[model samples]
Target: MSEPQHDVDPVRLGAYFALIEVSGLLRHAIEQQLQADGDLTFVRFQILRRLQLSPAGSRRMTDLADAIVFSRSGLTYQAGLLEKAGLVVRNRTPDDERGVTIAITDAGRALVDAVLPGHEAVVERLLFDRLSQDDARTLTDLLTPVRDHMRAAPPRSATPRRTRP
Candidate 1:
């Protein structure tokens, strides 16, 4: 028996492939620039940016992992490196002993400040330069729903912690 014809035709597949290719290339360029300019990895840069923008310059480890789609253990390792570098602090949350929070340090903030210009330049040169303002807005509008939908799903590291009564 022949396979049934369905949606996801050549056009859709090509579009998906193009999107993936662009994403990978853009990430590579950004990562290279980030490393060359400041010796920072993309993941570490993201963590610092998130913590810097967060209220109180901190977020729970799990939340940070979820936001970055990183494994909890992976985030823990990165946080450890940052801690050793004096770029961030990791401490148990007072309200929940099982929970750990990662906070950006002054050094992390300074590093981010130093890195932003290069980061912005890389992003703009790779992404924004390829599209008009309206095209960028359209891409955001189209992708936001897909991003929200994926984010709403159960994350891989969302293990529940038991609380003492």
Candidate 2:
């Protein structure tokens, strides 16, 4: 019951390699800065940043995991750390007794605010500065469809929930 294999193309392989390599380098540098400056892990920073950007400044825990491409248990563990640090809080959603929402605290916003300028600077220096304005736009245009297509598919996670006792 093995799936049929297609011949691999060198160009496509190179593209995948470049994407992974660049993403790893960028994440490492950003994480170092975030840890040093804000005492935050990259995942914690992302959770805070996403919550900060939400219209209601909160999101259901599952939705946050899906949006961030994090495992539900992993996100919950990170959220627990953030909560312990007083950067976030988890609350029961009023309408759904079983639903839990993660909300950024004032401290979370402050940490994000403090970390953002450095984050932008690192990104600009490492990634964007290498590209011309047109290059940036073209890259975005090229990636948008690919990203959207992947997102349209069913989620990769089979059990996308944190196990609650």
Candidate 3:
């Protein structure tokens, strides 16, 4: 038997899936280039960039996790790998011995600075070059609401509410 055809929801059939598919493709492309430069992955790049922007090129471990939007454990693991690579170091807070800060080493900044031009080229080649100025502006406007709502989403442990009868 042949499959039946039905109306396609344009947003679902076209937009949403296309966005995710492009994201996967972009991730693969960038990761491939990054791996060639070294073993650095995109996630590690993000972490290093965040630290690069901070005081003395460092931030509290908790703050780094939040800034990178990675779970604490995930951030810790990534930091550990970067640490082993001598790209970062975990230091006990001088003021509060109980706390730790993640510092981007000189090598980390150097690596990111070196690789950024290549990464920027990939992004430009993949998406930006294909977009006209007007289209890029429109895309940014369309994404703002989704970005805000996601930023405001309830935490994972929130309780579900009951519907009224």
Candidate 4:
């Protein structure tokens, strides 16, 4: 069957494609650097980095999943792997037996410290190097509202699931 046509203008379509392409390219490079530098996956790195940056050096699993826009199951699996590797610890919350809190270990902080320099360099070279300071500001301004609008939907951890009857 032929696809139905939509009435999107050429400029908007082009911008959407360009944004997608740039996102893919940036993610690819960042993933490679994370793997090579810290033997970490991009998602794993994000998890550790967020924990490391948090004031308490930890976060509840659901909050972590929401912040990273990762599925709860996937985050649980990754947290298990990190726990096995001695990079993080998962604990049951005292107030809620069902809740899990993930905390970065010293080793995890060390790994993030090791990997950050290369990650920053890769991002700077691949993205910011092409944009002037003013251009960067303009890009942020243009994208912030779109990001906020998209995030207005329920967070990944909060989204309801469909059940077959």
RMSD (CA, Å), each prediction? 2.3, 4.3, 6.5, 4.0
Candidate 4 structure lDDT:
0.93
Residues 133-165, candidate 2: write the lDDT tens digits: 999999999999998887777475422555566
Model 2 ranges with Cα > 4 A deviation: 1-6, 158-165
- Candidate 4's displacement at residue 134, Å, is 1.2
Q: Tens digit of lDDT per residue, candidate 1, span 43-146?
A: 99999999999989999998888888888999999999999999999999999878999999999999999988999998999899989999999999999999
Looking at model 2, residue 49 earns an lDDT score of 98
Q: Is candidate 2 or candidate 3 better by TM-score?
A: 2
Q: Indicate the worst ten consecutive residues by lDDT in candidate 4.
A: 156-165
The CA lDDT of each predicted structure is 0.91, 0.91, 0.82, 0.93
Per-residue error at 25 for model 2, in Å?
Answer: 0.8
Which sections of candidate 4 miss by over 4 Å? 1-5, 158-165
Using Cα atoms with residue i matched to residue i, what is each candidate's TM-score against the true structure? 0.90, 0.88, 0.81, 0.91
Tens-place lDDT per residue, model 4, 1-165, is 999988989999999999999999999999999999999999999999999999999999988988888899999999999999999999998987788899999999999999999999999999999999999999999999998787788665745444336
Error of 4 at 20 (Å): 0.4
Lowest-lDDT window of 10 residues in candidate 2? 154-163
Residue 128 displacement (Å), model 1: 0.6
lDDT for position 4 in model 3: 96
Q: Candidate 3: how large is its RMSD?
A: 6.5
Report, for all candidates in order, the number of backbone clashes. Answer: 0, 0, 0, 0
Q: Could you tell me the lDDT of residue 21 within candidate 2?
A: 100
